[model samples]
Target: MIWWAVLGAGLGCYLLKLAGLSVPPAVLAHPVVSRVADLVPVALLAALVTVQVLAAPEGGALALDARVAALAFAVGLLWLRAPFLVVVFGSAAFAALLRLL
Candidate 1:
């Protein structure tokens, strides 16, 4: 079952990519499509981060705690225009410290 799921997912992803490539270049080049495509990564990243922050460890109840603190710190760092590496490590360290307390 797991193998089937993995194969299906991989094939589906390839099909999606192929479909994207098969789209007419003119349509892809349209201003609205280009703007939306540009925002897709940002939207996806935000969703990913939100899920990670809100998900509970060990499949337990969802609740805010140290992870929220880390997310807050990361957001603050981003607001302050700190470098990407600093933002990531700082958030991780902050969360670890919170967890330890």
Candidate 2:
């Protein structure tokens, strides 16, 4: 039963990709469409980060933990134009320090 669901999801994803490919180049080239395409990944990544930070590991309840503080630290670094490695490592260290306390 799980395998059937997995296969169905795989097929659905393939169909969705095919549908995206079927869109006309003209539509894809429109200013609004192009801007949306560029921003979609950013929006998706923000949503992913939000879910990871706020969602509890074992249940549906929202969590407030060291991860939130670490995320804020990372955002501050980004606002300061810190390099990518600094942002990643700084956030990890901040989170580790918070957890260790």
Best by lDDT: 2
What is the C-alpha lDDT profile of model 1 across 1-101, one tens digit per residue? 99999999999999999999999999998999999999999999999988888888777778799989999999999999999999999999999999999
TM-score result, candidate 2? 0.95
What candidate 2 gets wrong by more than 4 Å, as runs, is none
Query: Candidate 1: where is the Cα deviation over 4 Å?
Result: none
In terms of lDDT, model 2 sits at 0.98
With candidate 1 superimposed using the best TM-score fit, by how many Å does residue 73's alpha carbon deviate from the native? 0.5
Q: Summing lDDT over every window of 10 consecutive residues in candidate 1, give the lowest-scoring window.
A: 54-63
* Reference-based TM-score of each model: 0.92, 0.95
